[model samples]
Target: MAAFNFTPSDTSLFILMGIPGLEAAHIWISIPFFTFYIISLLGNFTVVFVVGKEQSLHKPMYLLICMLALTDIGMSTSIVPKALFIFWFNLKGITVNGCLAQMFFLYAIAIMHSAILVTMAFDRYVAICSPLRYTTILTNARIAKLGLVGLTRAVFFILPEPLFLSRLPFCANQIIPHTYCDHIVVAKMSCGDITVSRLYGLVIAVIVIGFDLTLIGLSYGLIIRAVLRISSKKANLKALKTCTAHICVMLTAYTPILFSILTHRFGQGITPHIHIILANLCFIVPPMLNPIIYGVKTKELRDKVGKCRRSSLAATDFKPA
Candidate 1:
């Protein structure tokens, strides 16, 4: 099929269709989107806040959780708010630069999030497989360096995207049939050849996700082996229990995204509306669920979150005594 490119140029503004088949439900849709956005904000912020305020939770694991929380915030904030605007206020126009910026943060932070998970996997591996060297191997300084390296890697890979996009001639359809400024979606609108954009997008995604997931799998394989060697049922269960939350989070982070990618590539029979909905869920669901998963699964974070909740209640419910 020929490319969707029609005009030679639009007003340098791309209009986003919040949901192709559900225009009548956009108002109702905004309810859930807005709710998820607010919940994601409050939950991730609480993780950051409680982790920062408490000295006991300053270890590598919690610090890495903090990093994940920040990325969750960035990743969700990149799309949800704008999506809510489109749904509720009929605001869909995004400037070329605005779209590029959104696309950058969305992709960069998502891959950075994958890197953080890999680092967290390493944290779990060392803690379980090399308990004595956990601290020595993953000091605060080292975690910070890992974070910097992850950020740098994500940025390095994604920085070329906007340049590739900018050089395209979007002479036809400035209207993207989804909620956000996805690279492939934007590229399809351009009259200019998008081979580079398509190839780079696929390559970067595969490299980051494939590499990190492989590392995560290896780390967990070692961890499971070490845990099994303990030989005591109670101790083995306890060790495995610690990995549950990370594994849950890993699923949430990758499942929807990988599904979207596969369907986009292979599920050609899938409707565009279904594709957009799945992609939207890919962005929002993880952010909303990640902090809650951590808060519920990790006793320390759960306790601290409870304590913070109690403290806030007490402050507001105070008597003049």
Candidate 2:
């Protein structure tokens, strides 16, 4: 197959290096990536399935969890399969349009995750601060609308990324150093000045991640105020405890992401392989851990999961051995 030559008239094919400087460990590294991908899919899907089936879990909080699960699945699926193919089979020729599509889905789902976290924070806020009006305020119709708004916000903001990226001429080398097509990596490959692309990317990042963090922080602030006002120490502790899982999930989702962004853009001293590893972790950790956190923290979800396990075991035992 002919590799894409730098020509003004044709689409460029980008080759993704799974991990540039650590090619020797590609196979070993792929093992953990594969494991995380599988766990992310199974864990998140179980959360969605269980939350969907259990009538008691038909509340705003669980509904948001379902949305988060779907986002996690989408985010991981967009990047990991291609990465695994590059790692396992050394097949890394991705067309320009294909790369744009992957970038679009990856960032869109990431923004959606941030939006879902904000909504989850709001849910906790209402449940804690205004318990009586919680159901009335966050009714099924309202939750669905919020979900739609979040999706629209993500899609609207992320749509321009691929559009702008597609227009840029890639006259330079078509090799991408990372496992997947990141916006920064792809944008910087263009022969022309990429100030517009870079600025737009930063603008979108701020609008999505920064805005969501602000809202989430505000929501938690109010929740804290409400918790502090409670007369009984046990009630206050209980209220604060409900937020622990969400806080952990939030940290897992954003901390690595922020670190990855900072290191990629400014950490000139950092090694390329380390930056790539952190980038991969930004996608992997939250999805793999979210369902486990919720399952362990929420008794209702834990009970339902246990029931599901027992039923499956019983069915297996009843079958012909």
Task: Give residue 281's lDDT in candidate 2 (0 to 100).
Answer: 89
Best by lDDT: 1
Candidate 1: tens digits of C-alpha lDDT, residues 1-321: 112222436556788888998899999988988899999999999999999999999999999999999999999999988888888778878888999999999999998999999999999999899989888999999999999999999899999999899887776558888899989989998888999899998898888888999999999999988987997999999998998999999999899999998998899999888999899899899989999999889999999889989999999999896
**TM-score of each predicted structure versus truth:** 0.95, 0.95
Task: After the best TM-score superposition of candidate 2, give how far the Cα of residue 243 lies from its true spot, in angstroms.
Answer: 0.7
TM-score, candidate 1, is 0.95
Residue ranges of candidate 2 with Cα displaced over 4 Å: 1-10, 319-321
Tell me the lDDT of model 2 at 211.
Answer: 85
Worst 10 residues of 1 by lDDT: 1-10
Which lDDT value does model 1 have at 8? 37
Q: Mind giving the per-residue lDDT tens digits that candidate 2 earns over 23-129? A: 88889999999999999999998998888988988988888889999999998998899888887878877889999999999998898889889999999999999
In candidate 2, clashing pairs total 0
C-alpha lDDT of residue 284 in model 2: 86
TM-score of 2: 0.95
